[model samples]
Target: MTAYNKEEIIHQLESHQLWIDTLGKEGNKLGFDEVDFCNIDIDLIKYPLDQAYLTACTFDGMNLYGKDMHSSLICSSTFITTNLENADFYKADVSYVDFTNANVKNARYAKSDCSEAIFIKADLTNAKLISCSLYLTDFREATLKNVDVSSSSFKGVLLKGAKLSGIKGLEDAFIKSINIGTPEIPILIEGEEAVQWIINNCSTDEQI
Candidate 1:
């Protein structure tokens, strides 16, 4: 695991900003491989974090709207109360990330590995999670309205208190098991039964 001091990280961020300004003509694009950014202030890091390795980073209360993070390795990261609206995370490795209370509306996460992630109270309205791995992910109290999760694996996912109105593509997803209802008395459904339960209980007339 590589480590960078605050000044070094800021310098890299400046270079990356220059690269973004010059459209990849002058400065080199920033790419952190196996870097541990724990406790580091990443507010200076520029947008479009493409192809960077950000495993186990913490991004609390940062405004990261419309950032392109495609193919980035951001596994085990924490994004509490962060703004990720319209962010693109296509093919990113986001496994075990904590997104508690984050604003993740309209985020694109196609083909991402989001297994075992926590999205408690996060607003994921209109988000695209197509063809992703969501095994054991916890969406407790998350607002998933109009979200598309087609062709995803939902084995052992938790949906307690999650609002799933107008959510799409559950029929196409592979739902092996899911936990719903309160934690004290959790209700576990499996196979086609879980699919039907989600559709019947969570959907409304305005479904998409």
Candidate 2:
């Protein structure tokens, strides 16, 4: 992770604006070096980003902790192994984003679109995703501890072998074709199979 000055980093980001719309059309954006675009406080820029179109920008091993990216359109961006802890992603469209092995702990993604996003082996502990649209998102072997997924749509999402311990708010989340691991806590979904499985698991315990 090579470090650059504030002026040098801003120049690189500004130069890639023309090609940020489509990938391979102009040129490649975002280097492997650590560019602190979020932590910069310069006189040139007034406020942070809004509705920023950052397509195909790779952010591998970057620390994007606690950034508010509300309503941003980040399509086809690769966030490989990035630390996205406690990021406020309200209604953001992160379709086809590679979040594989990223630290997404306590991330709030209310009404966000995470369709086809890969979350393989990511530490998503205590993440709250209220009313979010997660159609066909991959959650293979990810830790979903205490995740609040209320009123969300999980159509065709792969949750096979995911650690869903202490997960909350599944009363309205659609579970079509989603692979459920051995639920330690009581699941809050519809269907006779789900009810029976919870009943069987709760029979030995005193609480229902």
Candidate 3:
């Protein structure tokens, strides 16, 4: 419940960077709770934010390529149009985050709780979402080619216009009612029928 000013936040970040640079021998790791990071420039911050509590932060349009954010609490954050390619979000609490138009290709979201998150038009090609909680998440018009969603929960997820060619582990996922059409039109499907439609429509070799 501590609030930090910009200068104090910068000092902590510098110390964390030193810790990362010296392999945890020089400084302490960054670990803040209930802090707001909307005003901060995320580009200047160092990578490997593992186990940090970054709840409700806004990282719009930032280049966060290959950042190690595993086990972080990033719930309700906004990453609009951010370049999150190769970012490791393993076991992170990403619930209700907005990733609209973000380039999240090859990101690792295994064991993460991504419930109610928005991925509208985001490119998640080749991403690993195994054992994740995706309940009520939106993926409208997103590119999910070759993505592995093994043992994930997709209850009430939106998949309208999402490219799912070469996607893996549909049978292993626990899917409930999902939207396969626009929000205005609202075509809902469930169980085996929904899986079949996703496979038949998106499993084609034709380019999307």
Q: What would you estimate as the lDDT of candidate 3?
A: 0.84
Q: Determine the C-alpha RMSD for candidate 2 after optimal superposition of all C-alphas.
A: 8.4
**Model 3 weakest 10-residue run by lDDT:** 38-47
Which stretches of model 3 miss by more than 4 angstroms? 1-6, 15-45, 182-186, 203-208
Query: Candidate 2 regions off by >4 Å?
Result: 1-47, 180-208
lDDT of 3 by residue, 10-65 (tens): 88777877887898899887777555555665444354577677777767888889
How many angstroms is residue 1 displaced in model 2 relative to the true structure, after the best TM-score fit? 18
Alpha carbon lDDT of each predicted model: 0.83, 0.65, 0.84
Q: How close is candidate 1 to the true structure, as a TM-score?
A: 0.82
Candidate with maximal lDDT: 3
lDDT of 2 by residue, 66-180 (tens): 8666667776777778888987778888888888899999998888898888888788888888888877777877877778888887765666556656667766665544434
Clashing pairs in 2: none
Error of 3 at 53 (Å): 0.7
Task: Kindly provide the TM-score of model 3 when superposed on the true structure, using C-alpha atoms.
Answer: 0.84
lDDT rank, highest first?
A: 3, 1, 2
